[model samples]
Target chain A: MKVIEPHIHMIARTTHDYERMARMHTVACCEPAFWAGYDRTSARAFHDYFTHISQFEPKRAAQYHIQHYCWICINPKEANDLSLSREVISFIPEFLAAPTALGIGEIGLNLNTKNEMTIFEEQVELAVKYDQLIWIHTPHLKDKLKGTKMMLDYLKGHGKIKPERICFDHCEEHTIKMIRDAGFWAAMTIYPVTKNSPARVVDAIEIYGIDHMLVDASGDWGPSDPGTLHDAIFEMRKRGHKEPVIETVFYNNPCYFLGQCEKFRLTPDRPREEAWA
Target chain B: MNSFNKQAALTPPKNASELLDIYFLDIRSALLESAAALDRIERAAGGKDILDDPRIQDLKRACNIIMDGKNNRSEQILLLLSHPLE
Candidate 1:
């Protein structure tokens, strides 16, 4: 069961996590540029963070026989600082040219604030201009429904950013329908303490049917555990979902969505026998 | 504890309704514990650091969701458990 972790903060994780993920059959993983647990003081900070994820992290993951990819952005949490964000966004294209750079993401609202939305829209335009994939982080808890609605309305109204090229992540039972109905890809993140659990994610898949759906760990500086993803896989198998169904949701779905970027080399139908060879 | 391994070996629920009920209970319990932990951390940190801490921000978000009465998963769960394929 080869997997592609569509969203994770690999820079915050140790190399041992990579070893575990590889053992669990994770062929690849993506690190989206996000808030580094603190507000960085300057664009130079983001420059270094991007470089670490893009350059250093891949080398680290490769040592475990896992290919690492990443998304670049100011991240919604830091996008509130307009001046700092502008400085950071100005140089994002330089990192985008890197081989492992996939698209602009984990870039949506934090507090659902006006500035966050402003930066989010600008980044969407940036993605559009550069013809890049967009991965979004919707607000959590009470704000999730409203924030996701706001993003959907904003993206739909813009009318130019293709829905298929964008994925709204951290979707829950409340928000998945609207996201899928609106024709955009939807992803659910599994967490150890705070967010969706494995069984709940399986419930979402069972109900919604995995068309454009994806599941990831969203593992980061918090108490998240990457193992929750495999737990979901195990949960699905326990629920009698066939191997093909599990493969589609965990492997094929991410490949289908992320493969829109030419840099993502794996495909849903690729011969598994040749994976290690 | 090896409780996860034990739980993994448990039999699958007979139907979507049963599955939904189990998942809702599990998720509810996890969220409640997370909320309680966050409350303790907030009290110890004295409210000031919550504004700057991203982990605290996530904790606050999760806590807010758990506290919201209107954010119940029962309706969605019911719909899924009932239709199972809509």
Candidate 2:
């Protein structure tokens, strides 16, 4: 099945990983700027990182026949350093002009600290000002529920933001309902080790009808495998889900969400008989 | 950088060994990045609490394995590179 990986850190991945993903039928992937497994010291570092992902990574992915897209932001993990965060935020708009750039993303609370909240709001404002799509990264494990609620409350109170234009990623069982109920998009990120597994992701799909929901592998520096996404697809198929349903979750859902930015090229496939004509 | 251009297609690897080479190269690079991140974190934190963290230990162990370059697959790659079949 054709897939669009809605959240992955391609900067941390290799070209062979792109090849493997292409072999798995990943037609497109989105890389959201995230913590480099550690904090970056300067805005220049972020600038170079952004350039690599926005310019270089797409070319790399293209070599493997995969269309690469990315999001830019001072990720929440580093947002605590307000000075550096502001410095990095200042130049993000310049990168936003890059063609492959999707929006300001993976931008939300890490420790749920006040500084993280401040930068998150500022980046949200930046997204609003530019009329860009948003991709949020909720905190992990224990902080997730509270952080997701905090983000929801902030977005609700913001008054200008549209629910459909934003996606709260890394959602779990405890957090998915609230995110979906509020009319915003929700994404579940499966991993090789910790966090949600393929079966759990399919379970979420069964529990919550696929409306504005998406699933991704969140391949990164940690113990994540991009193949886990296909494993989830296989699990869904094994559980008797129809091809169309699988296609919708894997392909069409991403198209529907990322299509909001006009730069996304792929269209959802029509039924077979219509295509043959 | 402002303009997006299509990249030229790359030929896929012909054999399983070539594919394994590509995969190992990526794994090594990723491990190096992880090692560098750990180093930065340790340095920033003055090597106090950072080294003690279990997560940091796990990353360090992964990095050591890849960097040693003496394992079965990596060693084979090294041998092939150092003594090419002419």
Candidate 3:
């Protein structure tokens, strides 16, 4: 039942949710760089927002006994506002040393915005400078396919950037293989309306094997959950997945990514419960 | 809770997918109360701190609204996270 949720946004989550996940045996969380845009206005506004993600959110998650670490980046949808993007970027370095601040992430393109590309590139450079991992976000709508390819194109040419130090998010049927082939971890966000489901996530693991697969709820401003990661694992078990394979996808792969954190702790193996045992 | 919204007799949440729309808005309401209590404490402590007192005022104005909004949204998230969209 051990798990490591790779893309939860604790800023939108409550402490009770964290306690439930911790007691359910969640080991760690690798939150991607995300926007708390429910009401954020300017770059100065997002400056405080990033600090909350890097500082307050993890502290709250810890109170529930779960290790919560996050990536820092301005999302592509906000790229059109260069002022906010620039301000958020400047604030990222200050959060690098926080025990739970994993990397520069959740950065990528939307609708082929040249402005988004610029923001993504600058953040990527920041990621490289701090020697932290990159958490990339592919577009979620009609332009996703094109945006995915463009994001990969940008990463491919960087001489000092290794593809292995990255996690590509919002991956679906179309983008999964491409991101995997490029040597990045694939994180499937399980949302009811837009992203993959608990069932689909399990199916993806069945097809991809446990090498570098991770799942999360992407619990942002949308209808999402901080506990869905655990629910996905349970659904996988009910669907006939072996406990060993389930544990690896839920715990092992996510920990592998968040292990990049300076404060990572070793996860221990536990026996799975059987109905008749 | 009404019958349509109340799945009180429904099967237990065997998985995340099963918990959708079946709220413990009951739980959300309770948590919101405690969060409100904390805000009152913060405002009390910070009395007259900004622009003669704007920071404290903003904190108070923000308190009740954020509590209600977060709880309502938490329910939406609980449903969305548990189930998959076609």
Candidate 4:
């Protein structure tokens, strides 16, 4: 089946990885702007990073025949610096106009700190002002539940925020039900270590059922692999999940969500279901 | 197949069987490493009653969770090993 890797860092991946994704039938992948494994020193550094992902990375992925899309934002990890964060946010509109750009995202809290929340709210305002889609990064491990709840409350209370147009990534068992119940998309990221394994992801599918659910291999700088997405497909197969159910999780679900943006061109095979049946 | 209708799409480079064949050695190596680590821990303990150690107990619990017939062993073990929400 044609798979859409809903969240990955293509800028952190190599052409060989792109080749593997193409061979595995990954037609499109979205890269939300994230930390570069180090603290970037200035807004100019973020300019270069966004430029590379929006312009240079798409050409690179085209060599392997995969569509590379991205979201532009001041990621949560570096949002602690107020001056630097505002400066970065000022130029986000220009990048958002890029054909590869999806929306302002991966832009939630890293530490659930006051500064991170402020910047996240500002970015949310920016997204709503422009009528753009949102992709969020909930904090890892111990901080995840609180951080997720924090964002959910803010978005739910916001007058203009539409839950269907937004997604929260790095979701685990404890936080997914709240996200889905609130009408937002919940994405389970498969990592080599320290995140949901392939078996766990499939088990979540079996429990949750796939409506607005998405699965991605967060192929980033840490100990992660792009093949984990395919491993999830295999996990579902081993458990006797039919091909349509597997297709719905890896392919159609992402299309239904990402295709909300005009820049994303992949189409879902089935009609969009507003609520999980 | 319910709502899906893509019957002529491109297949993955490696099907499920091919993937299992390719990764069998990797899985075996991981199991071996876990076994070796447990053996080293037991040897270092020198037959002391380490069963009461919380870490050992958790590991034992994790093993049982994995052996159970139910799916979601990973989630069960993760929640088991995780510190309670503070």
| Best-performing candidate as measured by TM-score | 4
DockQ of each: 0.08, 0.02, 0.02, 0.10
Cα TM-score per model: 0.79, 0.75, 0.71, 0.83
Model 3, C-alpha of A117: deviation from truth (Å): 0.8
- Candidate 4: regions farther than 4 A off: A274-277, B1-86
Name the lDDT value of residue A6 in candidate 2: 92
Better of 2 and 4 by DockQ: 4
List the pairs of residues colliding in candidate 4.
Answer: none
Please give the C-alpha DockQ score of model 2.
Answer: 0.02
Error of 4 at A90 (Å): 0.7
Lowest-sum lDDT 10-residue window in model 4 chain A: A268-277
TM-score of 1: 0.79
Q: After the best TM-score superposition of candidate 2, give how far the Cα of residue A102 lies from its true spot, in angstroms.
A: 0.7
Candidate 3: TM-score? Answer: 0.71
Model 3 C-alpha lDDT per residue in residues A23-140, reported as the tens digit of each score:
8787677676565565468777767767787788777877766777777788887887777788778877887777667788788886678898999888889988889888888887
Residue A62 of model 4: what lDDT? 88
For A1-277, candidate 2 gives per-residue lDDT tens digits of 7899998898888778998999999999999998987788789999999999999999999998899999999999999999999999999999999999999998999888899999999999999999999999998765776787889999988889888899999887767777877778899999764468887787677767666779999998888989999999987766556777788889988988899998999887863223211
Error of 2 at B16 (Å): 42
Worst 10 residues of 1 chain A by lDDT: A268-277
| Ranking of candidates on TM-score, top first | 4, 1, 2, 3
Residue runs of model 1 more than 4 Å from their true location after superposition = A270-277, B1-72, B75-86
